[model samples]
Target: MAKITAAEVNKLRKSTGAGMMDCKNALVEADGDFDKAVEILRKKGQKVAAKRADRESSEGAVIAKVNDSNAKGVIVSLNCETDFVAKNEKFVELANDIAELALNCNSKEELLDAELNGLKVSEKLIEQTGVIGEKIEIGDFRTLEAPFVGSYIHAGNKIATLVGLSAQVEGAETAAKDVAMQAAAMNPVALDEAGVDQETIDKEIEIAKDQLRAEGKPEEMLENIAKGKLKRFFKDNTLVNQDFIKDSKQSVAQYVKSVNKDLTIVGFERVALS
Candidate 1:
């Protein structure tokens, strides 16, 4: 049997982010062969991942990152089984690193296949499951691209948002960030009235009609009254039409226009842990 030194154990622990004891055990099991020890730890991760396949991983970090030019951004949620693991400094760091990598990828599938520290993200998540002793996975992956982009992450990493603008104006960063914060706080259902799906529109109208009927509104006026209520829904639930949280006197669209007449909110993406 090969004698495992403390240096060997620390090296494996550093490389795998596994606990010192786990690394030492893997090293011992592998007869002090570093490569074999890594394999053993990875196999442990696979076993843990498969065993916890049905576990709920609703708690994690929501991270947002943008490219150097600020023309593109992404929000990624690195989910774990508990808030304790989610808030771990190393876990959040991994999430931020993955978010940075995600800024270059178009979709979750691509991001998973992308390599991080010589390991594919999907593999890293599996490895982390063993290290964390909990399910670790990506819950949300969203991207936005425009002439300019900005992002915001709410306290506790509960919410993350990205906003894109029509042009890279003077205040584009500030405008985009403000809109992103608005998205995080207001939780708009759609970017605009036009963006709201017909199904949702119908449902809101139907709900309004029922409420009005309960109030004993004349049945003949139901259609018009429902339309009015739908308009109100648009005003409150859509990003551009919603009242600006900072200044209730104006809508989000107006606030963006005030920054620069040519600046417009082209798109946005939001991701939350819940």
Candidate 2:
């Protein structure tokens, strides 16, 4: 075995972000070869990742990123086993990196396989799992694209949202972000009544009818009353129809229109980490 100097160990530590002791052990195992030592550390991470595969990673960072043109956006969550790891600066930075990369990835599988900082994103996650001694993985991921896009990340990185606009009109950024914040706060089930699935609509109508029947309404009145109640449900549950959180007098659609008469909401996505 080659002599492993303290300087060699520190070099490995600096490169891999491993602890001094772990770096030293890796150097010893690799006979003081820097590249070999780095590989050894990563293999250790893979083993740790395998062992923790079943652990629930409920805590981590939620990040939202938009493209340079503001024509696209993505929200991504990096999951870990504890809040301690979630709050780590490095962990948050990794989440931000992933979110930036995710702005181009259309699916979770692509994001995991995409190269990041010379390492596959999956490999990086495995490496961090070993270093942090906890499970680490990518959780929620969503992408939205339109003529204009805006994003919001709630305080504490607990929630992230993206909203797309039909046109890139004046004040579109603030309007889109306002709606994105509303999404992070309200969590509408769909962008509009049209977006709600027929099954969900039927279920809501049936539920309303049941409630009205229990209230002693005549059977003949049940259909119309239930229809009216279903409209209320849409107003409360859909994004555009819902009252603007900032000004309840106007709906979200109205608020965006107020920003620019030509601007319209195209789509939206929200990811939450509880």
TM-score of each: 0.98, 0.95
Residue pairs in collision within model 2: none
Q: All candidates' lDDT scores?
A: 0.94, 0.91
TM-score of 2: 0.95
- Could you give candidate 2's per-residue lDDT for residues 166-271 as a string of tens digits? 9988899889889999998999999998999999999999999899989999999999999999999999999999999999999999999899887889899999
Per-residue lDDT of 25-125 in model 1, one digit per residue for the tens? 99999999999999999999999999999999999999999999998899999999899988899999999999999988999999999999889999999
In candidate 1, stretches whose alpha carbon ends up further than 4 angstroms from where it belongs are: none
For candidate 1, the lDDT comes to 0.94
**Stretch of 10 with least lDDT, candidate 1:** 260-269
